[model samples]
Target: MSQSTESTTESNPFTRPGFIVAAAMVVALVAVGIVIFLLPKGQSSAEPAPASSSTVTASPSASSDGGKSICGLPGSAETTLGTAPQSKWELVGRIATPTDPKTFGPGESDSSGFRTCFAHSPTGALYAAMNIVALGSSGSTDLEQKLADKLLVPGAGRDAAMRQAAADSRTTGSSTPIQVRGFLIKSYTPGEANIDLAFETDKGALGRTTLSMRWMDGDWKVKPADDGTTYMGATQIRDLSGLILWSGV
Candidate 1:
């Protein structure tokens, strides 16, 4: 059997050192089979326009047509969430580790994190309560525009994905987090806030992963965590919670 362990900082939430719990979720999983996967922000009904190397914000620039100013973009002084009103990203796809980060490209990486339904705290941090779902090594994402539609936690897309992952995790009358922590950053709009986070599982740990997001339309959205992965898009369901896993719920 593969040996691993993940420890979440149960001390002070603010001072606690974020964990990655990626040992088995990443390294050991490679010994078997599987790999990593993948954005965020914007609160508008994207009219399906041209997007290829999006026009990044300048000093917290403005979105097209009197759009809001986003804080999650690539260049912004002291970022904050819900800052952008226009910004789009896509999830080309996912790849296995023991592979090349370059070949995988970038967008967002789900490492030691809880359910996607979990919301980022107003303070721009993930809540400790999320440690419960931080199991396995899998990731997901959606375009920045989609975030505008469903920026709150437990949105339909996130909830659905979490339930699917939790249920699919079943094996031998039990579940085990696949052990995956995506680590990579690339580009962004500008002035978007970031969530420096990470988590732990029974089999692994993630050191710290900074989650970037911007406020658009009226809610917060996830930005590219880095050349990690692109936004996969949204689904139709909603609900809570977060990272660090054990044997059962």
Candidate 2:
């Protein structure tokens, strides 16, 4: 990438346009069991379109158990997995993310970067998976490297991701906005969870991906696939037939 392209990617990693194209590229690569955080080039440099005026603000419910957990964060009694979670949308890195403070946390944000803490429940795993996806696709290689180091499971996958981040830094691309459409908890246990997330691009393209999360150090960290990438089994969906059909839009 050229110096100008690198500067643009660093300056505004999340608000670029044509993310659907980038997502398509990812899907194609993942089909062959390879995943890389590369976005398509030559997209318009225009600012992202503003979110709708009717966007709802998040109102986290108070925990029934006096708002405390074993992790010393706000806790919720919701343990059973449900298809639809009560969530409101808020922009994170220009993507509309779902948040339910009482249930899933990002109970706290690390001053160091996009790293945030989540609850130790199934719902928390769901939130963590989504948040990581958004942050990983932010189009800033530096930010991605930091996230991989701090939020991914400690193993060869994490090491490989760090190396990939360093290589990606030399490349540059713009990021278009995408929104969380729905999710499905394939399986859940106290120690591990598999979450399937549905997404809609600004141009109405639909895509889906799965994340494997492991409970680590009192928080949920993405468990990398055998290929050493956090996102496993990504594909474009023609419809939301298998999804729970929920969205903040």
The lDDT values for all models are: 0.26, 0.59
Model 1 lDDT tens row, 42-75: 3333332222332223343333334321222221
Reference-based TM-score of each model? 0.27, 0.68
Candidate 1 segments exceeding 4 Å error? 1-149, 152-175, 178-191, 225-249
Model 1, C-alpha of 109: deviation from truth (Å): 25
Residue 44 accuracy (lDDT) in model 1: 39
Every candidate's CA RMSD: 17.4, 9.5
lDDT of 2 by residue, 114-205 (tens): 74678766667777877777675656566677777878788887777677666664324334356777778888766778888877766665
In candidate 1, position 38 carries an lDDT of: 18
